[model samples]
Target: MATLVLAACGTDAAAPADRDDVGARVFAANCATCHGPDLGGTDRGPPLLHEYYLPDHHPDVVFATAIANGVQAHHWDFGPMPAIGGLSDDEVAAVVAHVRDEQRRAGLME
Candidate 1:
């Protein structure tokens, strides 16, 4: 289970309905094991729903970069994140969109 943290701005902009679905599917297949299906913290990874993941600290691009290059452990004790392979650029974007949408729904973002 790898960690995939997605972030969102405080703006009201929303992801498209279709992209949201695709992103959710992609997330379930690749990220849910660690990140949880609801972006909640699992034993294996930190929660994206927390304030630490606010867009001010981690913008949407951070998610794409993390998935592409992985991240070192800095905020949590879970250990470094490993790069997620085999995702296309569009899939990455879709995952970001999904994460942003979930963040908004959880009130972590505007």
Candidate 2:
């Protein structure tokens, strides 16, 4: 797992106040094992905070699709990702929101 520590800013204009807590909880429960608590890559998955994951390249829809159907390894050498079952659409959306928030916090996205 790759660990990335970024300096936190006082405020993030892009983060939704309502979604933040839900997103964080959802991500921590389901994604943190592989994606890390900070969205950094774990031994099991690639980092979501990288430039390759910036919204311009990987849109919100792409995330939803990936979570529902799984994604073949294209960027990282971590191998193919399996579909994550048992997550509702809302949960998936919250996870994406959390990841995007972390990305912005890391300055990987605007």
User: Which candidate number has the best lDDT?
Assistant: 1
lDDT of 2 by residue, 1-110 (tens): 00101111123333575667877998888778888888888999988988888878987777777877889999999888888888766667767777888887888777
Which runs of model 2 end up more than 4 angstroms from their true locations? 1-15
Writing each residue's lDDT as its tens digit, candidate 1 over 1-110 gives: 12233323222245577668878999999999999988997999999888888779987777788888899978999999899999876678788878888899998788
- Per-residue lDDT value at 21 in model 2: 82
> Which segments of candidate 1 are over 4 A away from where they belong?
1-15
Q: What is the lDDT of residue 43 in candidate 1?
A: 98
TM-score for all predictions?
0.84, 0.81
- Alpha carbon lDDT of each predicted model: 0.80, 0.74
